[model samples]
Target: MTDPDRERPAEADDEQPVDAEAFYEALDARGRPVVTAAEVAAALDRPAGVVDDALSGLESDGDVGRLDVRAAKTAWYAPGRADADERITVFEKRRDVIVDQPAQYTRALLTQFAHLENTNREGGYVYTVREEDVWNAPYATFPELVSTVRSALGGRYEAIEEWIEGQWERAHKFRLATHEDGYVVLEAKSADLLGNVAEPRLDDGVLRARMGDETAWVAEDRTAELKRTLYEAGYPVQDDRELETGDDLPFDLDLDLRPYQADWIARFADSGSGVLVGPPGSGKTVAALGVMADVEGETLVLVPSRELAGQWHEEILERTTLSPEQVGEYHGGAKEIRPVTIATYRIAGMDRHRSLFDSRKWGLIVFDEVHHIPSPVHRRSASLQTKHRLGLTATPVRETEDQEEIYTLVGPPIGTDWEALFEAGYVAEPEVEIRCLPWASPAHREEYAASDGHGRRQAAATNPAKIREISAILHENRGSKAIVFVEYIDQGDAIAEALSVPFISGETPHARRSRLFDRFRRGAVDTIVVSRVGDEGIDLPDAEVAIAASGLGGSRRQGAQRAGRTMRPVGKARMYVLATRGTEEEDFARNRTKHLAARGVRVRETEPVAVVDPEDASATPDGGGVGFEAER
Candidate 1:
């Protein structure tokens, strides 16, 4: 049986006959060194279609090379004369090729040979021959290449020089625009080959131009200073978006706001967004709540931790007229959205939650511990549309430069004077003491020297001498409520065991932690040992003393937060920091206390204390007890 789909034998018409040498000679004899297929057909006395087919065959066989000029013009030259390694070519149009030739080859060739410059006067086009298009051309020195380019572009187009200068200027310019959604957009223009600039920088070196398909888009909230910076840099800016405004809605709360708290709410009402920096237990939360009540619409509160979220939920229900049914918790498994939603920063930044909040306009957004919002992960939540924003934090200064970003994102800072509060007897005045202690035992010193950076810090923080000093400080303040801060969980546990007090860490269950906190609040517990989890937004107004036994190295923010834990209105509070003298720990201690010192808190140095050598189990010259001099 014969199959119609079976392959058939080749016929005479299937393969067109083309004389390879004749085509080559014909191309070589052309008046113009490079000619199109039509010109080659005319010179060869052959049909244009036949000539085009022949040229394709020649290209595939490596006998000729093809150059795509402007529009539909395809120029052909001898393969050896137009090979990639021998010349540099620049394209006037953007195109994609399957296999890209190496750019270094062109650069090297340009360095050795004079570049070939082609100009299409009629088409208003000018470009140099690309390295990939160079097959076989004479190579010259780099100076010769420069001279060739200069000679080619000398007088034909004086506008080319102006265009080059214009490109340089464009690459450095940035413009500010407002997106339809009200976020600031920074667009960067550059003379990139494809006219696409990615991640460009402005003149100030701080603002970055984000890249888009055609232009760079900056999606940060812009301040007046940023606008002025762009204008000074000679870039046009467009900012037509209206500032957010909130209605002075009617509401009532039985709680009396402090004078400072009332001033913060009033300022926030005028601006519609701002950061309120106040000491812990200084009624910052109360001020934020007052704003929420006055805004009188859907409210979204973002907190740093789940515990804080729970705290906010409790406070809202107790202090406001809003009913429990109107409030919701958008955290973990409970993904409820209501008129008043309290969510942790982590959960609220999730796509599902962000979309839900962004789908509608919120009346007010309260960012607790707003300093955390400058981080990239938390900053995404700032994109939510809201009429009013209130940022509440004990520490407005961040460890990183992103502090500036926070100022722009939330608003300018309106801070309460901690020193003024202390002087006026509105907040507790702290007596700071820096107690220098001797190094640990000989064995411990050797271990510290032999360990890595992290291990050495741990050894310094957990020194036996420091621990003894902490014990002494605790004994001295036996009747006062105290909080001992430790960097590590094991340290907190050890200190808690030694002091016979309750300990709290991130691992503590909610109910147990709450009970422990309640016990401390009721004066049932004289001292509580806590890890870094208690550093921020935890109200411990009754704590009259703080002993910082361990901490992160040289973190001013951490130091400030720990000091703020005891800054309630009361008699003078005592803060004791135990550091090993003549070690890196001493340097870190100085750095840690710098923030406090800047705020006019006097640091008094106490005489050094010496301890017995634990390795030899030997007693000191004055017996087995540690000795300390009175404050100097």
Candidate 2:
């Protein structure tokens, strides 16, 4: 069949302009290609001048392009010629593609695909790698392949055979060199696959496809066609277009989730068990609660701090299907306890009566910030044995080695990075602007440089000038409702006093801290400075900003929690790290980020604080930890 003409004339048997359908019909009437205005007018029973005007309109709308124009003659049409296949488009035109898909077997597929690509280059066929193709596998594991194909290929398993046949006929003969249970190894010649008779040649690390055994290269426009063909054939997964918005949320919370949040939840719920790792405030609590709504029986949620336990209680009551009767809290100052409980990791980790050693049955146990599970006591308690487990944390484990151990104990990583959620508007996009306080300032930098080890971090963090700078920033953004994070109670007290904001430290009374968080969430107060106790699973949905004035230690869990405080997706949020120019405070801040590489958290220079409109009362865009640290 010849290509369908895709053009419309200015006028076709009408006093008014022809509609889009009529224009398409006119093109269909012209079997070969677009005709001259005179020819179109004759065919449409209209005057040549009217046809010319209509073609001009079509050209303006990108429906057609004019090839030539003259006084009494004119020709215009769509730019590209029709190919045999209309369902072809480009993939990852000019971007680098990472091989991360089907999360279950990403590494397995990467290994196989890379090996095949390297070994299969001997034949005449050429291979054109699209950015998105970086994530495909041989689909050797038929069952898993069937599931992925059904979801990705519009539930059309029948098309798989046809696509394979077409690819085989078009390309050099291909074979799965190694086909096993869940893995398949493939090798194919590019010439055979692409249906090009050109001999493939490598020039400067790029493989070029020749046309008709000639030296001429295929036009760049043809790349998309080739890519779309392979894409429909199920060679790879598409880039995530929807945000992780927690779409499969079991029970609808009175909240609107961003796309990334939905996606994250879906991935986890589908996987049944794994880690949901991202920077803090990425809505780990909300995500955990969402999962609890779907799971059968009671869920026990373990947090790291009392502040977090209380925060979880409030959020559970506010956002989950669980009733106060069903949900329980096992913490100090708790009046009632129920089946679906929220308990502190420290308390749960403690060997109160060595009861943890006994096998206790639970429908589901959620470890909020499960990275803390690696602690000797927590690990021992957690090792008490439970099959169904969910590790919810902004950062999971500290580094690769820890991740390996965590994987053996917990499960593989399930959720995508925080940036995925951030860019999709699931979480706010942070606007980062660096204000490099002068390192030459002798008062702070000099003292910090002279101190040794931990003292240096303390010196840098407590420097009068640096403190004043943070205090000023806090004062300026005071209306946005912020949290000042400090490493020690003394620092929290000092910073709180300096900024004149209410303080909650480890020593803060349970009832008082609960009241303080309540006041912060209600907008009755603006800022609350706290020690590390506030870093873990606490829910401060109203707080959109966090200031890390100190606590720049290498505790990946702490770093993740501090950043997470501002990532809650409650509205928009921003996290500010106040470092003393060039001090251990900065170095410690760097150490705090070591755990995020695997989880894909990119820690960089501080992002700009967003202006909070009192009328809106939403959090500002909290710059997610992605990309890399900026040079400050």
Candidate 3:
């Protein structure tokens, strides 16, 4: 039976989880060329013995070439491997694929069919393709998926491809479509499968009644749970329920979308849902607003913080024809729900606030920083039941469970090429470096050694030596706008005091914080020391240099956000990640920034010899150590 969804539509990349060629291409995506049976098993979510049998069959069929393990991992990893050589490594067993020196178009292609684990600085990347990735593949039909895989890999894996086919088939077994009677009904291909799979998995009250042998009435406000339950049960319910565009809030997009952004809007126009994952400065917010205008219904924009909410307020007012009265802020300071409301995730998820948002028939619900959607508290907002839901984020990095929940809650990951954006001069490529600073004193080293767990992390993160390094960077890049990031308020205060800059944190008065931020934006202030309050979604576009004096417990998202601060269109930007030398900080520094290193920024390491004395830190020669060039 040909399903309507499986039919080829004009949209090529629709974020469904199945594409024919993904399984075989997973084996070929970059890393070490020779994959063991265990790796294949992990990638396919099958057993090692089963993978070995499959590989053995492939070997017999002369479809797969086996190389000796003695070939050396580096030998298999061709430096800057291009499209023709296809320098991609697949550990199907681990369900991970690393693209080495990926072609610009390849990364864009991979996101359509795989979940990005991390990107490399050397134009390489790591991806994890699984049942969800294949099931949410952008293509409409199994044959189209196969065609994409063959086109991507220039070959195929019949065995794992079979696994992909089954998963894709599983995703289409059921759907929640609107009946002509204006009620949602769960329709399945077969009554037996629906009774056996759907009836058993859904909650007691969810399936209100049976309409026919293969369709059932879906309880009101139970659609989200029903879809989630069925999805976990290995059957992704296609939501074809009719969606209202809500009360018309007339507005026109004042900004022109890049080609990719336009394509994103087009694909989303068809499905009415998706997450726009673009790098910072790649204009995800712009694309999201574009979608808002396209939807043309009353919209609800949920942001991670009030700062972002306010930013969205300004952006909406500035970029669209929407009047200030048409838009309102709903967060800690405000609770006015207007035709187009922007609220914080914290408030939007609250019981009292839920009604104000849910009561409105929103034409669209845009989840900004969509990465926050998977959290326990934030996930509640996902139940708002907007037909056209859109999400926006620079870093979509999260736990597998959280990532999957985000995909399920909001929509599948949709992004443009980070490298392509950099290449096109749309976003500046940052010069990133991990600077290993010496301890301010032997006492600091002793304290770090004596501390344990979080204490140890804090000690290293707040090492006084980072101040000297930051000073040196500032001195060299004097007059350039800079922002120093710290993990603790105390450290932020100290850095701000030494630098003679304002320290903005959660405790900062809203008016004062706004004043400081405004001055910095206008170049009235050259720098500011801010805590986690400045870690995300702040519009500091003129920031030329960013220094991370402390790590956020080594979170890759935080690292990327810090580096992303200096990334803008048509400028040279630089980022410095400071870690105390001869400590665990070295490892933490590397671990956090590796995500940015590969995607578009090539990270260099520098270990300085000089140490700064805390008592006379300012007297230190040129801020503690002769600067070394990018490490070999």
Candidate 4:
């Protein structure tokens, strides 16, 4: 049998004579000794078969060597020019491929390169360093190899250090520790150094240098934020912050709950910490009590005011198995600390008494009107240790950026279905009327124009025309329960005196305020004027009407709270806001009503009605009224 690869054919006489030596010399002149059969044929102006025959003849004569460059392709090279088995070099080899000076590599620079490679995982390049030959890893190209080596030797050793530090970070454990000065420090275990492990902003001198072997420090109050960041970055964290636990005082409570209230309680039980947002009079207190019952341990309740604290105390006694002996009040002159304690934010946040509560263990801590918890003074309560935390509020928003702090401290907020509750008749359907009263008294208008921003606003908010409107509203709703919300104590007093009704303010004695609230609840007093103290966290379930004579400047929280004061379903409850037309009061009223307007409550406007001037007539203030024409 003949070998097909070795077969050769006879060349015709018309074909030009093949010059193997000249062909090899021409291929060498082109800077490559290897010549394919097709190139030989083209250079000789002959067919490929003819060139193949000549190459076979030359190979038989042992003057030229054949090499298989690839499948079905042959190359003729001088015997010593190249080797067939050698691997191709994609880049040039240089003596400086390995960096000599280690200090030239920086962690940040290496991290930059590593991040580039890491971000493109499918690029077939390895940027991570290994323990062996980690610094001298192979490069994909000659230029890149030269550039990387030169950078490593050019006083940038931190690059290599950063890569190694990342490796250490992935395997180490981190923890938090509080310093005596109230600052927090981060410490690491099994870490040789803390090179670029955390953000540079946290690298104060105290922890940066000493982090050489198994310890690092940050001198900021944002330890919680830092912990989250580090944990997300693939660092193992062992949280060391102290958490206090109260005595397990279990109890059973017998009470009926609405479906949504029970659902919120179940959610609280699962998470152990969260904010419950519901409309006013939606039984947030009942849900909180249900959480307390489920927790079955010592509970501490925080409120925004003394009145709210008293309300919480009363609710705990009325609704829970815990008696008055188990509950205690921590506001004002009383500093009792029982299994179930109710304290105002002012009392709980007091530096002198903060330690008393901070040191004790609490199973549950309930924050009423939790929106106030974002304030700097009130935020201190966030650090208190409790197994379960519940924040209850009718209005969970604030007009400030501190609103985010509430979520960070407590947990994510879960809100009740306001529309669902309203449809189910669990809450009132508000009929809001915006009475655009004309600014009364030329003296008042002149004073308002002459005053600065604050004084001007006060003048418009307290215009005598608003008093006339309030009087009309009171008379329109006569013989029914009503609460008038005033911005100032003097304004509440004036309204109460003119209408011959009771009034309450911050300075009103606790006993007298309680009695007044009771009288208003019953039919003894048809109306009562209260200051901003009644805007939030006070239960006035039976009042069918709320009159807003004055309010804070453009505060949605104040507006929502005031509207919520009459949110108890009582046969189409009404909220009457009296604002002077074309003044700052109108602007403020618009700002306040925006939140309510979003919830499908239209503020119907009413033209001012003419009435007998109280100063000139002997007519009763409640009866000398104006009729309203609802205008959307």
Q: Count the backbone clashes (under 3 Å) in each candidate.
A: 18, 44, 31, 14
Q: Per-residue lDDT tens digits of candidate 3, residues 382-441?
A: 888676889887777763445666777787667655766775678888888888877676
TM-score of each: 0.61, 0.54, 0.78, 0.62
The stretch of ten residues in a row with the least summed lDDT in candidate 3 is 69-78
> Tell me, what's the RMSD of every candidate?
31.2, 19.1, 13.0, 27.4
Give the poorly placed runs of model 3, Cα more than 4 Å off: 1-128, 136-155, 597-600, 608-632
lDDT of 2 by residue, 314-350 (tens): 7878875656676667766563435666777666666
TM-score order of candidates, best first?
3, 4, 1, 2
Residue 347 in candidate 4, Cα distance off native in Å: 1.5
**Model 4, 331: alpha-carbon shift in Å?**
1.6
Per-residue lDDT tens digits of candidate 4, residues 205-301? 4343353465555544455456445544555343444344778878776689998888788777665567887778788889888888888889899
Which of the numbered candidates is closest to the native, going by highest TM-score?
A: 3
Cα TM-score of candidate 1:
0.61
Worst 10 residues of 2 by lDDT: 116-125
Q: Which of candidates 2 and 3 is the stronger one according to lDDT?
A: 3
Winning candidate number (lDDT): 3
Instruction: lDDT winner between 3 and 4, please give it.
Output: 3
